[model samples]
Target: MDNSQTSILRRTVSSDTYKRLCSLWQQMAERKGQDSILLTEETLFSVNPSLAEKKYRERFCLLFSPEFRALLIGTLRTEDLLYQISIIWDTRTIADFVDRLSEESGQRTEIQCLRDRLQQILIAQPSNNPDLQCHFTLKLLDILTPETLGGLEQMYPRVSICKPVEDALRQQVTQERLLNQVITQIRQSLELPVILETAVKEVRSFLQVDRLVIYQFINESSAENERNHSSQSLGRVTYESRASDRIPSILNLTAEDDCFTYIPRYTEKYRRGLVVAIEDVEKAYSSSFCLVELLRQRDVKAKLIAPIVVEEKLWGLLIAHQCFETRQWFESEKNFLGQIGEHLAVAIYQAQLYAEVQQQKNTFEQRVIERTQELRDTLLAAQSAHQSKNEFLGNMSHELRTPLTSVIGLSGTLLHWSDRGSALSLAKQRQYIQMIQDSGKQLLELINEILDFAQLEAGKVLLNTKEFSLQNLSRQVLKNLQTEATNQQIHLELDCRVEPRHDRFYADPDRLQQILFHLLKNAIKFTPADGTVILRVWKENNYAVFQVEDTGIGISEDQLPLLFEKFQQLEKSRQRTHGGTGLGLALTKQLVELHRGTIEVESTVGKGSLFTVRLPNQSHRQLKTTPASKVEERVTFESKSIVLIERDEEVATLMCELLTAATYQVVWLIDSTTAIGQIELLCPSLAIVDRNIPDVYHISKTLKKLQTTKSIKILLLSDKITSTDWQSLSRKGIDDYLLKPIQPHLLLQRVSALVSSDQNSENDKMKL
Candidate 1:
């Protein structure tokens, strides 16, 4: 029935007139074996003889008013509970019909119930079909006494007139009960797979469809190892349902078939939570030939798909298919499946969170195990290093005291000899003086080695690269060491096999000298009397190689690796001939590595040892040879001002003397904290500031930004230059950086260059 008619009939079940008429109509319809049962005025009066008395027409009119007839007409539809209901109204009604009914004592109860029921009918005012004029059979029924209906009964009257309405109500109740049960089960299901499986089965049976399946879209996030392994999109049949006589199941069909092509379409719809329903797959997706073929193969004529959304992301799909024949999906079925997808999304989201938490737990446990092992290894290494350091310190104490004792004794003896000049020989006095000098030199060399090793360990060493003749540097090194070689009774020889093109290589000449000196001195110390030591230089590819070979007591295979270790000595005997602080070779390795080079040792015990040093033949951009004239010919700047911002009193005084000697106006600010004000006032051509000065970074930044000092050239001085410090100062417009213990000539040259560059820039701007 249409909604309006069904609502009206349902509402009338509580009406007295509707109840009385339904009883009479059912009785007559059963007797005639038909649905139509009309009650006319003549038949109604025969049933109730009191209606033929005074003002009977008026009485009928009161019970069958136009308002009542309109309500009945609006209620009765072609699909209504009642097939037909008519009321032929009598126009002769007078105003005494209600009074006549009131006067009947036996009918008063019936009339009062009718009056109350009619008053409670909540029909809309002025019905849409107000022109209807019908005689009310309800009026006669209202006037008839219950005793008269029992006395004039023809056969037994039917008592089941409201069966159609009852049946409709029952069906609605059943549908609601089933839906509630399904919803409760889904909510209570904790396992995601189980929930989805149950939902598909329930929905399939409830809809009586041929088949239903949940086609889940397994995207990268949902699939483990998808990103690391495969690039193809995938779909899996997570849940499926079927009838016993239905088409073959398409469950777990994830092969690279036609279904794979539909992933893009499914993903788009799932992202937007869109629903797709097809009455006939072939007709709706005709252009999707593969999809059509796949469905036909499965004997699926109709289909429905919905999205399962979890946390605003498309997780998967909920699909239903009708395989037996072409089936049109109803709105109600679509709504049911959509609801299932939503609940499933919640379950799946919870499952994914649980999985992620477990994964994190596993990862955290594995990291903890690895970290524990690392900490154990680090503890063992620290203990070993501590023991080695203690042993080295003990050895160092002995080494230092031995030289100091000799110097002290020899000097005291010389002092005593001079006091007793006549008692001591002239030759003996000269020998005592020579012994003192030798002991002092040995102590000084040991102290220097220790300091160099300390600096290397502390990462305080900086390279001073410059262009120099490698060939010339080697010759100078050999010449300086010739006396030492003679004293050791060893033959020292030079083998220069380097290419002419590589002879003039660029590097830190002084550091390179120290490295070569350590290697050659160690070789001479270990060589036997009359043993030969060779210093070899050659060019190979991009490297300039130097090898120091000695025919001496060579190292054992087990001790080769330990040769370059700090404070390590091969000879542990108390009567060993060779003596050293054991820091020379370690410092050599460090120096070589600082120049982006490597040092390797090759030795056979009781034969000889060969130490090879390979340094990259690279040229620095700021390379310059120390010209003999530049060192002596001092440049004078009579009026050009220079600011020296140094915190050290001695260094500042030394620089002040140097600048004044060169005829340059100098402003020495010991308190660097307020140097900027003096700097602005003097507006010097160049400012040399110590990098360690307090607030140096702030000072540099301010000086670069200040208008008064915008053109002032800045030079930074530090004990060691790190890459970070260099870049930071450079970004602040510092013109140059100079390492501490600065060479007088190099410092002056850098200052002159910076001031000259500033002048050139200003001149260029003026010309522009």
Candidate 2:
């Protein structure tokens, strides 16, 4: 501590450095004690000669620098003296050597005792002031034994042992877990609106902000159901002391495109996952420009926005705001807001899933109801058809029986009086025969109509399509109706727009001819002697239009709609004179429609009527190839067993005669009651049983019982067969149906085909 050493120390510490050092020492001494003086460079050089030759000024400059001082005393406290001394000793050995010398002189006892006592005092002192702690650490280290310093190290406060810091961390973890639990419960228990409100309120409280809002993007193409349930508004007051009017409208600023527009850039720096943070609303340019202005007008300066991502997709935003000056948000606050946003995203996704499930349920219910109504309508239509058929049958039975009885009685009288002089004249006999023939024809036509209608209704009508000359078919119809037309003196005109020889077309020739014959017959029945019936044919588009125009007793407007309905005769009272089964036009229309064509009628009450038929002229290649002439001539019957099981004596007799003419060996039974026993005896090739016979089911069962008769072709003849009756027969394996009174030609044809086809099939089966 000489004058030269002092001058060297003074030169080492500049004016600014001296002032700073003096201030630090003065503060330390005031807080600690008057003996707590800083160790000068001269005292250090006196103990070590290498220090005296060294650059004192340069060395002192480093020691007094802010960086070095901060390292020595920044976080040091009275209890940290041993740690600071150890750090200072590591840089210089002179301090440690000096302390050892003092200890050897026996003068170290006084310093050591004082240091120990000061250590106790500092350890017991509460850590209220950081400066007092630093002062004690510097002073105590100057007096103590630098060796045997391990005891002093124990009193230092290491960062690892700070109880308050650990407690603070534990509290933060508990708060996060509790917050998470609350969010989960809120989402589960509440609807979207309630959940959103709760989330905003929680975020506002956690952030210590004035207000919070959840703004969701509105999809332009939202469904009707979504539009009704979507969140329209969500916000909450963070503080009860705050004014309600201070809660600015968040909607006025946010648009569909504003969310997540500027969020990605600062996500890494902040690490809080916010989309945008308006630290000062007035200074920053945001896409939410209007909203910023509104917020500023209401005195808001700071805001934190987090994007709501549902199902990993950005949905909208969660906005937390302050009404005062710009507030610096902490990392914890940002994290809390992010958690609220995440919970809200999940809630929104769940709500949407629930909505979808409900929509599907509603659609399924609507479909089921529609299907049920359709089935009901179809059942009603079937019931109506059944009732109409019953009425028709009743009316037909009376109409047919009256004519049949007269013909039979008249024929018997002629036969009985043939031997007497008063026998009927030849002219009268011929007239009676004609009456019988006419009545038979009428009955046959009625039976045919019923069969046709049944086939159409059952969806079993078959068309025999072929290429034929239209003119030739028309000529044939004219020839067949010439006698009737001549009797009525009605002129039948044929208008061939195309060449007669060039009028070739594809169609079901037999059905078409039948339709023409019926139309001509009707026209002749209603027309006067001088009236003309015209048949015209032409081509249009891809159809051939055939029109039958009749100058007859025309139909009225009220009667027109009923023209094509079954059993709907225009003149109920004059039905007999204009005799028909009233099914011709209906059958015609049905047949046309089956070909995917159409039939239409035009008429004026007193003038005339025109019936037009349009058939599709599909290309010949697309049409089914016509069967060979020989194949067409052959009728395929589905039965072969020939058991004549008729109940009516006269009808049975006629059937026997017809079968015999066809060379069919018949096993005749007068009643179906004994038919099954006879079928076993004869093992007949076919059984022709009357469906109306007594014990019909028993006969069917018995036939099924016989091994030989099990596969027999049983033809069921009836005056009429209903749908239920037909189904019953089908279930019992009845092969075919024949309506009576039977046509001799058709019967002979059916029997021949049935026997032949059965024989051929049996032969083939035996070979197999």
Candidate 3:
């Protein structure tokens, strides 16, 4: 223990390395009940060595000094040699003793001393993989100095080999074999149960765990009808494994006591691909007695759960348990479970896709059968219509000649009487004029019927859908037919059962009026004097129903089916009582179909006939309506403003009055030149503009671009808007469009709806 022994140690090892090693050797020597021959730096620098500066230097060299660490590795030469010497001592014990000595003496100990120098070298190598490095090092050392180990044994025969290093080598080999088997199983098949069962059995056998299972959180129910009622109670014990006679099976159990209820809490823990390991369930879930009790029932003293994620959703669980006794779960086991869950999710997804494809195939076959029957029925109807068309042409030729001959003869007699200056009674001349007028009207009616039938046949009509008052439209049609109804001595009456507000619906109003007019006119023409014609309208579900009943000469059952056919009339003679071509009802039927509506007629042989029309209350382009009672009253909207820009004086005056009555402050601009200034000045919630107004699109663009007026809804009014014009108007951001001659009540309803809808949307954004 003098300077002579120090010189011997310094000659064998580096001076700095020997100093650090001496601190380590002394700790071991003390534990062995012997005195250390080496001196420590703490004892040498013992003058207030506990000062912060000296302590920092010691920690710095221990953790980060490359030069000092290099000297230690060079001195020990191999981690194997360091391990052999440590058995004559102990690395953990020496480390503990050095820390205690430093605390007691108030100085830095040799904390960085490489007592396990072989392990240190292996850790510093790339990947920190010691098995490959240890194997190669052992081979090289045996070849270079086979007798070196023999010399060490003679000095210290009690040296023990490191058990952990050997154990790690065996585990690595087992994991590699298991991983290769699993990957091959996954690649072989996509069946759900097969993939999951293989994973559970193989992973359990490799990890040497008592039990393993894949517990899934079932989001969908096996019974689809029960899904909405109670999906929370559903989960399956999908797959399971156990050691020989180690524990009872819990597979396929859907008992109420199942742990599926804990999925919500566990999902948060493992949603981000985390692994959870519970060494002891009692200790882990001490605050949650229910969770602990759930495990205890299954004799699970320890457990681990890993999440299976598919498409970024928590799909299910992969669980492992120690049934007989508490066991600690390792990082490697958790990682392997996660990999298995991922592969199983892929297999399950593929199975689901296959089931969907099979369902779609079945649905497609059923649709084909239904469509084929419809085509067959249509072909038969077409054959019957071919015969009726031939008869129509011959009857139409004679019908045309009679009207033409009357017009020519009556007009020539009047011209001859006037040119010859002959005495002719005023009453006779007047009668001749009346005959000419009636013939001309008959001729025009025939021509119009043909044109309408042709247009319907060629599919040339397009519906201009808009919200309009059905009650108001029907009244207008009846008013126009008053003269004809009076001359025919037929009484007209309206029986409206629809709510006043509900009577306003979306459809092609012009076309609807035309259908009503034709049906009413036909009723009056067939009905005798003192006969009554009644029009009834109501709403049921999403359809507006209209029925026109007349006390007329009713149709027979045999001829009723042919009533709507082209040119097929009950009286098919040239001198028929109807005195016209029989295309009216056919054209009316086609027009009803164009509006996605149906018309049907029921008649008794002599009592009366009832014609009913059902049209959808809403169109795709129509805004959804809330019930009238739910709407906020128009009187409460006195602060809102509207701008009316119409070149037509009468229409502008009418629109302004309607808007004003609805509690909107209206600014009426008759001239197109001043419309932009008026609309901007008013800053209205809505602007009603005539489509014919000069520079209307430019005005809409300007108003839309400005910050203050950008949100103002623009409703374009056009007398005849084509399909292309509608598209152009939509691009300019027109909110709603009204055809010219729109009813006053309909205009008010539309404006109120648009403004209210805009206000509601803005409120939603503010809430967000």
Best by TM-score: 1
The Cα error of candidate 1 at residue 73, in Å, is 22
lDDT of each: 0.67, 0.60, 0.66
Q: Least accurate stretch of 10 residues (summed lDDT) in model 2?
A: 62-71
C-alpha RMSD of each candidate structure in angstroms? 20.2, 28.0, 18.6
Across 155-268, the per-residue lDDT of candidate 2 in tens digits comes to: 432422323433433434444554666567655664676666655655566566876766555543122213333343222222122225656554444332232234333323
By the TM-score metric, which is better: model 1 or model 3?
1
lDDT of 1 at 254: 60
- In terms of TM-score, how similar is model 1 to the real structure? 0.52
Clashing pairs in 1: 87-134, 87-135, 88-134, 88-135, 89-134, 89-135
Cα lDDT over the full model 3: 0.66
Let me know the TM-score candidate 3 reaches against the reference structure.
0.43
The Cα error of candidate 3 at residue 128, in Å, is: 12
lDDT sort, best first: 1, 3, 2
Residues 1-768, model 3: lDDT tens digits: 122221111112223433444444344334334212233343435535445345322211121111111111123424333321111112233344445545645444343243234235334531212333233223322322325435544665553433443354345446655665666665676566777788889888887878888777674422321322343545668789998675878887553423334444445456577888888888977876676777788888888888877766677778888887888776667766776777677777776787778777876786788678778877876776676777678778877999899999988888888899894799998898888898898888788879878876775666666788878988898898888888888899998888886877888788888899889988988898999999998999768998999999999999888889787878856447765577878888887876657899999977889999988654332223322331122211222667788777668877877777776778777777777766655556788888888788988888899865788889889876767888888888787888767787778788988889766765575456
Q: Rank by TM-score, descending?
A: 1, 2, 3
Residue-by-residue lDDT tens digits, candidate 1, 101-180: 44553456655554444333323332211111111222333423344434323322422244465444443334444555
User: How many clashes does each candidate structure show, in the order listed?
Assistant: 6, 8, 2
